[model samples]
Target: MPLARRSLIEAAAARFGWRRAYGTTTEVDQLLNEQTETAYRDAPDHAALATAKNTDALTVQPGVLDARGRVLGEVLYLEGLLAGARNRRLPQELIARLEDVVDHGHELTVLLADTVRATAAAHTAGH
Candidate 1:
């Protein structure tokens, strides 16, 4: 039934300007808004979250192992150079080239690890 009604009493109320529309926030809506704000306000700092995130990334993610593998590759290359330096009378030019190779490999590994970490950070951040 319309609030603006045909009954004499309702007509009298409407005409007398006593009739009114009413509304209130639903409990669920109010609760949701409150809980959401509380959750956000009480949440940990972004750096803390990222540290926790990277800890997980270092353990469970395959990228960590891939990063380790790259490091190992560089270490082995450098180890060979070291062994050659100690054992054989190797050419200076050859040693220099091997040093460059190992240095480049190390740089590449660091870059790859950083990329992997950034990817993990993005995932943890819900990006």
Candidate 2:
């Protein structure tokens, strides 16, 4: 995979807790790696920008909830790209990887939201 794509993928994996099974290599991982390489080759500028944005978001966000929100926003941005891919009739395989990324983003968003809510509830109870 291209460096830009690999960096972005690593950042996302770290944020979302995506893990490869200990003993199994999955199709999703292969497809994602291939598609990200292709994507970087085709759009190096975009890939670099995305990687930078993700890195900056992680570093610059003020608090836990803010960082989560930034990640959620990045996911929404990626969904827009996925929509474009669908409209352009890109390969189903590539589209599938994009969908998986978006799905993970949604999962992270929900998990963060729940955490925020639980924290607020605890604070209220303490007060």
Candidate 3:
């Protein structure tokens, strides 16, 4: 997944004619890398929350909502990035890749939202 993410970043950089200094990383790159790693680390927790039947709803619901919010935030961020790329008149291929990334992010948001909704429904039904 990191390789795929790096390739996408490289393609975007190439499209924008961005040059990086040797042996140095930009602040923006560092932030993005950190966010990607955080998302990867949180994935297992999200899955566990989704499948947690024995856990209390009060405990699981917060995690479900938090995961959903994070994914939704990421989707929004990607949408903004895609809009900026489009405004800059980037190549169609690069634009397409950005769109694909945004779409995938949206899918993740949807899945997390579903988990949140299911948790809510189960909680209500139990009470």
Task: Give the C-alpha miss distance for residue 114 in model 1, angstroms.
Answer: 0.4
Pull out the clashing pairs in model 2: none
TM-score (C-alpha, index-matched) for candidate 3: 0.56
Which stretches of candidate 2 lie above 4 Å from their native place? 1-62
- TM per candidate comes to 0.42, 0.51, 0.56
Residue range 13-75, candidate 2, lDDT tens digits: 888888533233565567677779888788758556655664533332235588688989999
- Which candidate number would show the highest lDDT if scored against the true structure? 3
| Regions of candidate 3 where Cα sits further than 4 Å from its true position | 1-54
Q: Judged by lDDT relative to the true structure, which candidate is superior, 1 or 2?
A: 2
Task: For model 2, give the 10-residue run with minimal summed lDDT.
Answer: 54-63
Model 3's alpha-carbon lDDT is 0.78
User: Candidate 3's residue-wise lDDT over 1-127, tens digit each?
Assistant: 3657866887889899996443445656775787799899867665554566546665677766788888788889889989999999989897999899999988888887788788788889999
- Cα error, candidate 3, residue 75 (Å): 1.5
Q: Count the backbone clashes (under 3 Å) in each candidate.
A: 0, 0, 0
- Per-candidate Cα lDDT values, in order, are 0.67, 0.76, 0.78
Give candidate 2's root-mean-square deviation (CA, Å).
13.8
lDDT of 1 by residue, 25-114 (tens): 564465467669889999879677656665644343564557669687767878686678747868877677777777777777777777
